[model samples]
Target: MNAQSPKTVDDTRLDSVIYQDGIMRISYTLTKTSKDEIDSDAFTKDKKALAASVSCDEKGLGQFVKSGLLIKYTINDSSSAPITDFQIGKSDCL
Candidate 1:
């Protein structure tokens, strides 16, 4: 796995969507894997990055945690137009 950050991070490479409830849903496909890596940790980090991508108040973010979803992946400017900062946590759908 190339542990280096790409020069140009493509939003398409990192697609995230914010629902009406303010929970940001993010997904990614890992290009590399390690035997020691845990799936849950990877997912959590990605979710945090997604949360960082948005611009929301800590209080607003609290709602996500209260709701059980935790932000994992956060990439600022994940899209063409600047979108609102989002939070990620546990989701029943997932």
Candidate 2:
């Protein structure tokens, strides 16, 4: 599924990058920006800062780099029991 889904709009928030020795760890975060509906025009202006870490080991070392978008949206329906979609873009970084 595309990360641009309505439900994935929150999972693209702040993420964590962990480096262990020559190994690298990565994570992604989804957050709710506001309860208000997002505007198509404003949403198109979304952008995120890509970051990563690598080791200088002589042997093959692990590297971690992430580049993606952070989405924000609200639950417009209270009676729907919350419809959430977790299937978003592939993790091709690993």
Candidate 3:
């Protein structure tokens, strides 16, 4: 008999509508194979970098840069609370 390891997959979801501040937030739930959790400072830094890389020019109205980002990760299946939640953005995004 042969045994195979289970594949790990992470799911990410985005809200249908973007916030008024021109920020789009995405959420991801942690799984058993995922890391314990990340600190606020690290989370903030990473999310900001991610937001900067994303393009917000959906309407073709010039090049719109990503001003901010918010990321939240939930730990464990029992708890509804998030393990880490972070948001970063620019003041003059619009």
Per-prediction TM-score to the true structure, in the order listed: 0.27, 0.22, 0.37
Candidate models: Cα lDDT each: 0.42, 0.29, 0.40
Q: Per model, how many backbone clashes are there?
A: 22, 4, 1
Q: Give every collision pair in model 3.
A: 68-89
lDDT for model 3 comes to 0.40
Count backbone clashes in candidate 3: 1
Could you tell me how far off, in angstroms, the CA of residue 46 lies in candidate 2 after the best superposition? 21
The model with the greatest TM-score is 3
The ten-residue window of minimal lDDT in model 2 covers 48-57
What is the number of residue pairs that collide in model 1? 22
Sorted by lDDT (best first), the order is 1, 3, 2
Q: 10, model 1: CA deviation in Å?
A: 9.1
* Model 3 lDDT tens row, 1-94: 0122222355332222234555544444444323345564686467555554443344531143332443222222213345555443343234
